[model samples]
Target: MVVEKNAPLQPCNTFGIAARAQTLVRVRSVDDLLAVLADPELAPAPKFVLGGGSNIILTGDVKPVVLKMEIKGLRLVEETPKAWIVEAGAGEVWHDAVAWTLAHGYPGLENLALIPGTVGASPVQNIGAYGVELQDRFESLDAIDLATGQSFSLDAAQCGFGYRDSVFKHAPSEAQDGSGLPRGMGLAGRAVITHVRFRLPKPWKPVLGYLDLERRRAEAGVEHPSAEQIFDWICDIRRAKLPDPAVVGNAGSFFKNPTVSPDQCADIIAREPKIVHYPMPDGSIKLAAGWLIDACGWKGKSIGKAGVYEKQALVLVNRGRGAESVTGGEVMTLAKAIQTSVYERFGIRLEPEPVVV
Candidate 1:
C-alpha cells in the first residue's frame, strides 16, 4: 500500500475534478487495507471506495482517505450441466470480468459489456444497462467492516438492492463526532466491500428486453441471436451513442431515467402525444431522461468549462479545465437546471446516477 498526502485527484475521477485527498491509499490486498485503516495518522473521515474512476463527480477536494481498490482475481468455481458459478475479486474491472465469462462460454454476463468500474462497485449501484442488472446474477459479496476490520459475507437479499441503490449507500444513521454520519460509516457497519461472487448461466439465452436492442438486432438481420451476438450488438450501440471516457471525460449517463406512475405518464403523453416512454410490466412508466433534457434545449449547451456533450445530453463532459477551472461546479449547476426544468415540465425529477461529492 502506498499512502500519500495532499494527493491530486484530478486524474483519479472520470469528471476530472481538480480536487485533493488529504490522504490517498492504493490498496493492493486486504491486509494493506487493514494497515491503512489502523494508522492513526490518517484522519477518521468518511471513506470513499473508488474503483475504475467511472460514475463519480468530484465537487472539490475530497477530505477522506481515497482508497484505490486494486484487488484482482478471477475463477470458475462450479459447473453443472446447466450453469456455472464464477467468482471474481472485487477489484477486477467489471467489463473484463464480463468478457472473461463470455470467453469461457458462460452466458449470463454478456449483456453487460464495456461498463466502466470494478466488480465490487457494480453491486453498490446495482449497475444495469440494456435490460440487465448486477443483482440479477449476484450470489454473494465479501466486505470488511471499516471499524472492526472484520470481514463477512452478504447474500443478494441482504444487499437491499432497489433500482440502483443498496444498503452500502443508504445504511442506517449512527452517531458521529459532529457531522451527521450513518451507522455503516461507524464501527458496527462502516463496511468496505473487498470481494464479490456471481453465479452465471451456462448456455445463456440472450435477453432482448430493451426496444433499442431488439430493433437494432433485427435491422442487422440477426434473429434468434445467441448471447455473443446480443453482446456484440449492445457494444456497437453503446460505442455509437456514448463517448469513450478515455477520449473524453465523462461518467456514463449523468442521470437515471425517471420512473413515473401510469396516470402521470398519460398526462405527459396527452400534452406532447409524441413523448417516448417505456412501460414497466408492474404498471409503472419510465420516461427517458435524455429525451426530457434535450426537449429543454440543454444538449450541446456549455456553461464555462463544463457542458452537456453535444453527442449525448444525459452525459456531462469536462472540457479538460484544470484544477483552477470551474468546470466541476458548472456541470453540477447544469445538471440541477436540467433536473428542475424536467420536473416542472413533466412533474418528474431526474435523479443523478453518478455519485456526487
Candidate 2:
C-alpha cells in the first residue's frame, strides 16, 4: 500500500484549481483498497474516493484521505443474441472507452462522445449528452463499501438514477432501510466503484433526436450514418461550444438544466418570451440553463479569476493559469451570483452540476 502526504492536485482536476490532498493513496486495484482498509492507522480515517476529477471543485486543500482510483481494464464480459455485455474498469477514461467499444464494433456509447471523467464517475452523476445517458446502457456495477469492506453489485434500478443524480450522490442514512440494494438509500462517500459493465443492444440505432445532432445529420446529407460518424460529429460540436480544460480550465456544464411545471414554464415564457424549454416525457418542462445564464448576461464575464465561457454561459471557467488560477471560492461566488440573478429574474433556482468539496 503506497501512500503520499501533501500530494499536489492541480493536475488531477479538470478545473485546474490549485489544491492538495492531506494524504493520498493510489488505488490501482481492489487489493490496494483492501490493504488501506486493513491498515489500522488508515482504516479509521475518513476518506474521499476520487476518479478522473472532471466533475469536482476543490475549495482548498482536501482534508479527507484521497483514494485516487487508477484501476484499469476493458473487455467483452459476455455477448448474447440481443445485446453485448462489455465491462470496463472504474478508472478507465470514459471517452477512450466509448471509442474502444465503437472500434470493437459495439456502438451504443457513441452519442456520449467527448464527455469528460472516468467510468466510475459516469454512474455517480448519471452523465448524459445528446440524446443518450449512461443509465440507458448501464448493465451493472461492482463497488466496495468503504465502511464495511463489503463487495456488492447493483443494477440500474438499485442505482436510483435521475437527471444528473444517483444513489452515489446522496447522503447515507443509517435508518433509511434495512435490506439489500434498496432504492433511496444513499451511498455517497460510503462506496467505491471498481468496475462497470454496459449492455449495448445488438441492433444499433442512431439517436439523432437532439436538435444539434439532427441538424448535423441533415447538413451532412447522409441518410443513414454510422456510429463512428455520430461520435465524430458530437466531438466536433462539443469542441465548437466548449473550452478544453487543458487550454481554458472548466468543469463542463457547471449547471444542470432546471425542470419546472408547465404553469411555471408558461409564466417564465410570458415574461422572457424567448426562454428555451422542452416538454419532458413526464409533462414537466426542462429549461436550457445556458439560455438563462446568457439572458442574465454572464457570458464572457469575469469575477476575480473565474469567468463564464464566452460560447456557453452554463460553464464557469478558470481564467488564470497555474498559480494564478481561479480558486473554488471565486468559482462558487460567480455561480452564486449567477444563481441569484437567474432566480431573481426567472423565479427558478438553478442547481450546480459539479460536486463541491
Candidate 3:
C-alpha cells in the first residue's frame, strides 16, 4: 500500500480534469486494501474508491482518502456445458477485458465493446450500449464492506439493477440492524468492488437490433453475423459516433435518455413531430437526449472552457488543455444549463450519467 500526498489526478480521469487527491493510496490487491484499513492513522478517515475515472467529475481537490483500485487479473473460473464463467480484476480496463473474452472464444460481451472505464465500474451504473446491458451478462461480483472490512458477494438480483442504476449508486441510511448492515437497498459509499464474474451463455447469438448495427448487417449482406463481426461493427459505430476520450476529453454520454409515459410521449410528439424516441419493452418511451439538446440549439456551443460536443450533443467536452482545462464547476454549469433548457422545452428533467464529486 503506497500512499502519495497531493497526487496529480489529471491523467487518472478520462475527462482530463485538473485535480489532486489529497491523500491517495494505490490498492493493487485485496491485501493492500486490508492493510490500509489496518493502519492506525488512515483507517479512520473517509475514503473514495476510484476505478478508471471515466464516470466521475472532480469539482476540486478530493478531500477523502483516495483508494485507487489497481487490482489486476483475468481468468476462466468455471466452465460448464451451459456457460463459461469469466472473472476480471477491478483494475482491468473494461474494453480490454471484453476483447480478451472474445479473443479467448467467449462471445457474449461483444455488444459492450469499446466502452470506457474499468470492469468494477460496469455494474455500478449497469452500463449499457446498443441492444445489451451489463445486467444481461453479469454473473456475480465480490466486494468488501468499507465499514467492517468484511467481504461479500452478490448476484444480479441482489444488485437491484434498473436502467443505469444499482444498489451501489445509493447511500446507506440510518436504518441499520444490530449487524451494521443497511436495512433497505443502498450500498453507495460502503462497498469497494474487488472482482467481477461474467457468465457468457453457450450458443452465442449476435444482438443487432440497434439501427446502426442493422444498417451494418444489411450493408455487409450477412444474415448471420459472428460475435467477432458484431464486435468489430460496434467498435466502428462507436468510433464514428463518439469522440475518443484521448483526443476530445469527455465522459461519453453526458445524460441518460429520459423515459416518459406513452401519454407524455404523445403530448411531446404533437408539439414536435420530429422528436427522436424509442418504444421500450415495458410500454415506456425513451427519448434521445442528444436530439433534445440539438433541438434546443446547443450543439457546438461552449460555456467557458466546457463545451457541448459538436458531433454528439449528449456529450460534454473540455475545450481547454492541461492546467487550463475546464473546471468541474464549468462542466456542471453547462450541464445544468442544458438540463434547464430541455426541461423547460419538453417538460422532462434530464439526468446526468456521471458521478459528481
Candidate 4:
C-alpha cells in the first residue's frame, strides 16, 4: 500500500469536484487494509473510506487518510432452485455486478441496472432505483471494524435500513443499556464494508412496478416480459433518460422524491387534481419531486456552471466553464433554491439523495 499526499480527487469522484486528499491510501485486499490501520505513524489521524465516489460531493480538501477500497472479485457462494447467494468485493463497480447478474439470469437486480457506485456503498444507502432497493436482495455484508481491526457481518434486520438510510449512514450518539450503545458506527469511519452478499432469485417472474416500464411492456404487446427482455429494456430506458456520468458529471438523482402523508397528498390532490402520487405500503404517498420542481419551473435552470439537466429535472448537471470550476457551494445553492421553490409550491421540502461531503 502506498500513501500519496495532496492527491487529486477530481478523477475519483463522479461529481468532478477538484479537491485534494491530505493522504490517500489504496488498499487492494483485507491484509493491505489492516497493514495501514496497524501502522504506528498513522494511528490518530482521522480516516475516511472512498468507494466508487459516485455518490459523494467534495466541498473542499478532506483531512484524513482517504482509504480507497480496491478489493475486487465476484463469486457464487451457494445456489438453490429459487435463489443464488453471490458475493461481491467492496471495490467492484455496482453496474458491473448488475451486468454479471443479468448475464447469469439473476432476476432481482435487473431493475437496478446502471446505478453508479461500488457494491460496498450500495447497502449503506440502501440504494434503490426503478422500484428496487438493495435491501430487497441483500443477504448480508462483511465490514471491517476500524477500531478492533476485526470483521463483522449483518443481516437485513440488523442493518437498520430505512428509505435511504442504514445504521452505517447514521450512528448512535450514546451508549444503550442492553443494545450496547448501538455501536456508534456509521458508513463513514467506524466500520468499513469489505464485501456484500446478495440473494437473487434465478427462477422468478419479472417485476413490472414502474409505470414507464409497464407502459413500454404494453407497447410491445406483452403484459409480462421475460427477465432478459426487461433487463435490456431497463438499460435502454436508463441510457435514454439519465445522462451518462462518464461524459457528464452527475450523481444520479440529486434530490430524493419526497414522501408525504396520505392526508397531505389528498389535500394536494384536491387542489391540483392532476398531481400524481404513489401510495406507499405505510399509507404515506411518494410525491414526484421532478413534477413539483417542473411545476415551479426549475428544470434546466442554471446557476454559474451547475444547472438542472434539461432532460432530467432530478439530475443536476455540470455545464460550467470546466469540471474543476464547478463547486459544491454552487450545487448546494441550486439545491436549496429548488427546495425552497417546492416548499412554497406544495409545502414539501426536497432532500438530496447523494451524500454531500
Candidate 5:
C-alpha cells in the first residue's frame, strides 16, 4: 500500500477547488484495501472513498484518510436469453464503460454516454441522463465494509436508490423509510464499492422520453434509432449545453430537478406558465431546475469565484483557477443565494446534488 501525504486535491475534483488530502491511498484491488485494513497504523482511521471526483466539493483540506479507488476491469459476466449481465470495476471510467458495452453490442447504456465519473460512483449517485437512470439497469454490486473488512453485495432494492441518491450517499442512521431497504442503516463513509454489474435487456429498447432526446431524435429524423445513434446524440447534446470539466471546472448539474405534487405544479403553472416541467409516472411533476434559476435571472452570474454556467443555469462553475480558484465556501454561498431566490419566488426549496467534503 503506497500512502501519500498532503496530496494535492485540485486535480482530483471536477470543480477545481484547490485543497489537499492529509493522507491518501490508491486502492487498485480488494487485496490492496485489505492490506490497509490489516495495517495497525491505518486500520482505525476514518476513510473517504474517492472515484473520479466528478461530484464533490472540497470545503477545506480533507482530514480523513482518502482511499482513492482505482480498481479496474470490464467484462460480460453472464448471458441469458432475456438480458446481458455486464460487470465493471468500481474505478473504471464511466463513459468508457458505456462505450465498451456498445462496442461489444450491448446497447442499454447508450443514453448515458459522456456522463462523467467512475462506475462505482454511478450507483452512489444513481447517475442518469437523457431518459435513463442507473437503477433502471442495475444488477448488483460488490463492496467491502470498512468497519469490519468484510465483503458484501447488494441488489438494486438494497441500494435504496432515489433521484441522485443511494444508501452510500446517506449518513449512518437507523431510520427506516419503509422502502424495503435497511435505510436506517445508511452506509455513508462506511463501505467501498468495488465493482458494479449492469443488466442490459436483450430486446433492447431506447429510452427517449426526455425532451432533449425527443427533440434530437426529431431533428435528425431518426424514426428507429439504434443505441449508438442515441449515444452520439446525447454526447453532442451534452457537449453543447455542458462545459467540459477538463476545460471548464464544473460539477455538471448543480441541483436535482425538484419534484412537486399535482397541486403544487398547478399553482406554479398558474404563476409561471413558461416554466419547463415534466410529468412523472408517479403522478408528480419534475420541474427543470435550470429554468427556475434562469427565471430568477441568475444565468451567467457570479458570486466570488463561483458562477452559474452561462449556457446552463443548472451548472455551477469555478471562475478562478489556481490560488484564485473558487473556494468551496464561495460555491456553497452562491448555491444558498440561488436557493433563497428560487424559494422566495417559487416557494420551492432547491436541493444541491454534489457531496460536500
Candidate 6:
C-alpha cells in the first residue's frame, strides 16, 4: 500500500470542493486493504473509506487515512430460473453498474439508473429513485471490519435498511459491559464494504408507479413501456430536473423528503393548502422538501458562493468555480437557513442527505 501525504481531493468528490487528505491510500484490491491493515505504520490510524465521492461534502482537509476504494470488477455470479445475481466491486460507478446490468439483460436495476456514487455506498445510503430502492434489488454485500481487520458478509436484514439510511450511517454503540460490541443496529465507521451483489428477478416487470414515469409513458403513447424505455425516461427526467455534477458542482438532493403523521399532515394542509405531499405505504405523509424551500423563498438565492438551484430548490449549488469554489461552511449556512425557515413555517425539520466530512 503506497501512502501519499497531503493528497489532492478536489477531483475525487462530485461537489468539486477543494480539500486534501492527510494520508491517502488507493485500495485497488482487497489485498491492498489487508496490507494497509498489516502495516504497523498505518494499521492503528483512523481511516475513511471513500468510493465515487458522489455522496459526500468535504468540509475541510480530511485528517483520517483515506482509503480510496478503486477496486473494479463486474460479473454475473449466478443465474437461476427465478433470478440473476450480479456482483460489482466497491469502486464500480453506481450508474455504470446499473447500465451494465441492463445491458446484460438484467432488468431490475433500471429504475436506479443515473444515481451518483459507487456500488459500495449505495446500501449505506439506501439510494433510491423512481419507485425502487437499493434494498429492493440488493442480495448481499461483503465488507471488512476496520477495527478487527476481518472480512464479513451481510444480507439486507443485517444492513438494517431504512429510508435514506442504513447501519453504515450510525456510529457503533457500547455494549452492556462496554466491550465494544455494537448495541441495536449501527456499523458506521466500523466496516468497509468491498463488494455488492444485486438480485434481479426473472420475468422482468416494470416499476412505473412514480408520476414522472407515468407521464413519460403517456407522452410516448405507449400503454406498457419496456425496461429500456423506462431507463431512457428516467435518464431524461433526471437530466432535465437535476444538474449534471460535471457541469455544475452539487449533490443531487440536498435534503430528505421529511415524513409526517396523518394528523400532522392535516394540520399543515389546513395552514398551507398548496403544500405538496404524497401518501406513503406506511400511512405517513411525505412532504416535498423542494416545495418547502421554495415556499421559504430560497430558490435562485445565494449566500456567498453557495446558492440554491433555480430549477430545483431541493438542490444546493456552488456559485463559484475552481479556487473560488464555495466552502463547506457556506453550503451548511445555506442549508441551515433553509432548514430553520422550513421548520419555523411548517413545524418540521429537514435532514441533509449527503455525509459531511
TM-score of each: 0.92, 0.97, 0.98, 0.95, 0.96, 0.97
Q: What is the C-alpha RMSD of each candidate to the true structure, in Å?
A: 3.5, 1.4, 1.0, 2.0, 2.6, 1.7
Model 3 CA deviation exceeding 4 Å by range: 177-179
Which candidate, 1 or 6, would have the higher TM-score against the true structure? Answer: 6
Which lDDT tens digits does candidate 2 get at residues 155-266? 9999999999999989887663444333366999888999999999989888888888889999999989999999999999999999998899999999999999999999
- Residue-level lDDT of model 1, residues 27-56, one tens digit each, is 779888888778877536677778877888
Q: Estimate candidate 4's RMSD in Å.
A: 2.0
Per-residue CA lDDT of candidate 3, range 1-357, in tens?
A: 999999999988989999999999999999999998889988899999999999999999999999999999999999999899999999999999999999999989999999999999999999999989999999999998888888889999989999999999999877988766676679998989999999999978778788899999999999999999999999999999888989988999999999999999999999999999999999999999999999999999999999998888999999989879999999999999999999999999999999999
lDDT tens per residue, model 6, 1-357:
678999999888888889999999999899999999998988899999899888888889999999999889999999999999999999999999989988989889989989989988999999998889999999999988887777888899989999999999999876623433365688888889999999999889999878888899998999988888898999999999888989999988999999999999999999999999999999999999999999999999999998999999999998889999888889899999999999999999999998899
Clashes of each: 2, 0, 0, 3, 3, 0
CA lDDT for candidate 2: 0.93
lDDT per prediction? 0.80, 0.93, 0.94, 0.83, 0.92, 0.91
Pick by lDDT: which candidate is best? Answer: 3
Clashing pairs in 1: 174-183, 184-190
Misplaced by over 4 Å in model 6 are 176-183
Clashes in predicted model 1: 2
Candidate 2 weakest ten by summed lDDT = 174-183
Q: Residue 7: error of model 3 in Å?
A: 0.3
| Colliding residue pairs in candidate 3 | none
